[model samples]
Target chain A: MPGIEDLYREIILDHYRTPRNRGELPPPAVYSEGNNPLCGDDIRIYLDVADGVVRDVKFSGQGCSISQSSTSMMTVAVKGKTVAEVQAFVRRFKHMMTLTNESETVDESVKLGDIEALQGVVKFPVRIKCATLGWNTLLEALTEAIK
Target chain B: MVTTLTEASHNMSFDSAVIRRDFPLLAKQIDGKPLVYLDSANTSQKPNAVIDAMANFMRESYAPINRSAYTLAANATEQYEGARAAVAKFINAKSAREIVFTKNATEALNLIVSSWGRANLKTGDVVLLTHMEHHANIVPWQMLQQERGIELRWVPLTSDFQLDLTSLTSLLSGVKVFSFTSMSNVLGTINPVEKLCAAAHAAGAISIVDACQSVPHSPSDVQSWGADFATFSGHKMCGPSGVGVLWGREELLEAMPPFLGGGNMITDVRLDGFTCAELPAKFEAGTPPIAEVVGLGAAVEYLTNIGMANVRQHEISLSSYVLDLLTNRFGDDITIHGPRNPELRGATFSFAFRGIHPHDISQILDQSNVCVRAGHHCAKPLMKIIGANATTRASFYLYNTTTDADTLADALDSASDIF
Candidate 1:
């Protein structure tokens, strides 16, 4: 079992303490809301897209550490990526999070970035929802952008 | 059976080392620290009494309750009825016929709304609920609302987390069925059911009390409260899982259609139609949680031997001690939700330390072997009402102590620093 040290490394806490892209985007954006009804986690993801690119992204909500930190990390991951690339990353992130060792592999080159820290989540099944809340919002917002 | 309020309070105490021995888990250490479990409002730990009661039934007299025309069958049926009777006595229900076993309190709540609400509630009727309800109480009615087009009305909670009775009066007029928690599992608010039931009746609404949190800790008399129905779980009171009690008025149970119909729930079956089994049997379909019901019966007996008045007083005193400990140690670093007074609350208190997410606090507390609940706690609307994503909660039972509270306080201080 990977220890909490792997998940709560200084990098993860830094993103949580000083979140990047922590504000609202302007109008003409696809907006989506994802709430973990069981745990009281609510986050609103807003995306600024023009011509198949995510120009900017922002989110705001109240939740526990794994959720809010996950959201903060998600905002940083997708901010500068193209719309299609972000969607693929969402699928890859979800697959990696499910931690199916036989069926999934993450690109250690991209480093899994801030998300690599969340590997400790797989050991705690109840907390898997906490780690995925923000990622689900990313999917929701992207779907809205595609439509 | 009801004691005066003062007497009940006076007889309860915070010094209960003997009670701690009853719970085997309380003595152990977690992560090299003594286990300070305060999540009873979620689900309580089982004592030997409940465990032995279940093991005893499985070993001495374990048989299916359905008809088999044998000695074992008769014994099994008797034990099942005995459990129903025990449940009725525990909650002061009018008859054992009124007790229906469910999978959990959530399923019990669903049965009432789906079965009773469908037959009685019509379009444009309002189902009044509080914002602080567990999703079990909210979502089932929302399903009904979608079908029947019933208005989903909220009895807004006050800023401090108490039910806004002033707002409730206006919403109660159109309400056909009123469902609410006797005590919030998360907020620990103790609502006055007798008075609330009175108002709901005056407004011509049937009251359904979600006693999931209250019944396990306090002595309850559903008959005196004049509630049409009340729901609670066995797991929360140290009984085994897959067993919950839905105590409704006898007439209401008889009148409502069978929630789920299968072999055991049917009296007569034909190609054309089926005659449903009477009263309690009609609602409980398929095989029931036999061993669990027996365990719940033992739980009632155990609580009775300890005295419910004593149990409730112990919880309040422990809650107050923790409240004071948090105030003295953390002070402004801690922001507490719900009423400051333990009297106004159940055993649970939702709070947050500034700059520390609940997951962080809970994880840190876990390092100290302190078991608490973190997250929305199945009370999101309440969470939104309180203005937080999540909060750390420590709920107690009769077995908890002030020493446990002190440890929790110390853990919070460390957690605040850890975050």
Candidate 2:
């Protein structure tokens, strides 16, 4: 569980306590929502993307710590990245979660910082969705915005 | 089981201290103390009778039942069918031919959707379910909705957790089937099955009750309830897992097509077409869980000996005790879900602590050897309606006691402090 300590460790607690970019980014902008009704995880993700880059990203939702913290980390990770990079990061993060056969090379370089604490989630198969809710929502928002 | 334990130590009666010994898994320490098991609603622990029934079946009658001519196969088939008869009698069904074996309640539900539902429900036919149904009851119908364009509607829960039939009058109109759970597994709400069935019957709708929660803890009579079809699992009672039952009306069974087409379900097969077997067998394909069926029959006998009335009384009493203890101990600090009155509930009680996550609560409780189910428990929409992300649930059975309630309260008190 070495990499796992990165996913569930205390630093993630700090992000959960004081989530960065945790709110709406006005109406004329990107919007997306994701809900894992099973665990009552629902989130509304909004991003203010200017040109090809995400100028801002934010989320607000009610869920367990794993979901809320993961959302918070997702906002932090995707705020400054390009739409394509955010999608790739989300794809990689989901791969890390499912740890399925295809997701061999995870986002090893993108230091999610304390968000890495969620790496422990791979062991707990069921909670993987909770750990990646925000990232998924971000992807959805970007997908809609691109279209 | 009772005999050996009684022989080892002359103690009988439903005492928590003595009953805990019956559960072999209860011996291990969880965190630093005795583990408090609280998630029986999702899946109850196997008592000695259930475990022994399975073991005895495996050791003594280890042959495939039905569709064979061998002597051992005959005995196995008879015993397996005898179990089906036992289940039929348990639920007051007319005959064992109406009981189709399944892996769990989920498959039993799928059988209806795949067989009777697919054939009977046309496009635009509405499938009405309650909002409090477990995912098992909801998802299969969702498939019908997705694939066949069948309309799906939910009967919302009353403020106190039971179905509010009064509010769903319009929704019931034009509905072909009224499928719902007899009891909420997460909320522990004991729904009024007769009233709901009466409503559905009046509306010219077929009723399929998910009696998985109620059948194990209380006596169920499909005829008495007037339900078109009812489903439950053996393990929820004193039986082994991997076995479920679908109690349908003989008319429905005789009419519905086979869900899984395999060896036993067909009487004859040609390249162009095939004829179905008989009632229950037609629905049950492949090799059924013969040993588990036998064990489930033994389980039915075990529950009958104890008496279903006694089991219900014991569980409701325990639930009241648990409610009293939780209300007194945590008060406003924790939010207990479901009705306040014990008469409205069955064997489970779910609660969420303020300023604490249910996962954290379960993790802490586990340290004290208390096993509790945390999270949405597959009742996510219900959780949303209740305004909580997750909850820790404690369920009851005939074997549980006031002292176990006390131990749970104490450990939860500890969990409260820790979280």
Q: Determine which window of 10 residues in candidate 2 chain A has minimal summed lDDT.
A: A1-10
Q: Tell me how many residue pairs clash in candidate 1.
A: 4
- Residue B393 in candidate 2 has what lDDT? 87
Chain A TM-score from candidate 1: 0.85
Task: Point to the candidate with the largest TM-score.
Answer: 1
Error of 1 at B174 (Å): 4.5
Model 2 lDDT at residue B104: 94
Residue-level lDDT of model 2, residues B23-81, one tens digit each, is 77766664346656666677767767767877877888778866678888888888888
Q: Give TM per candidate.
A: 0.91, 0.86
Q: Provide the overall lDDT of each model, using Cα atoms, as 2-decimal numbers.
A: 0.83, 0.79
Tens digit per residue, CA lDDT, model 1, B115-188: 99999989898889988899899999989988989999888888788888886778898788889999988888
Which digits, one per residue and each the tens of the lDDT, describe model 2 over residues A21-122?
A: 778888668799898765566899988887889888778877666788888877777778887787668766776676436635565576555555677877
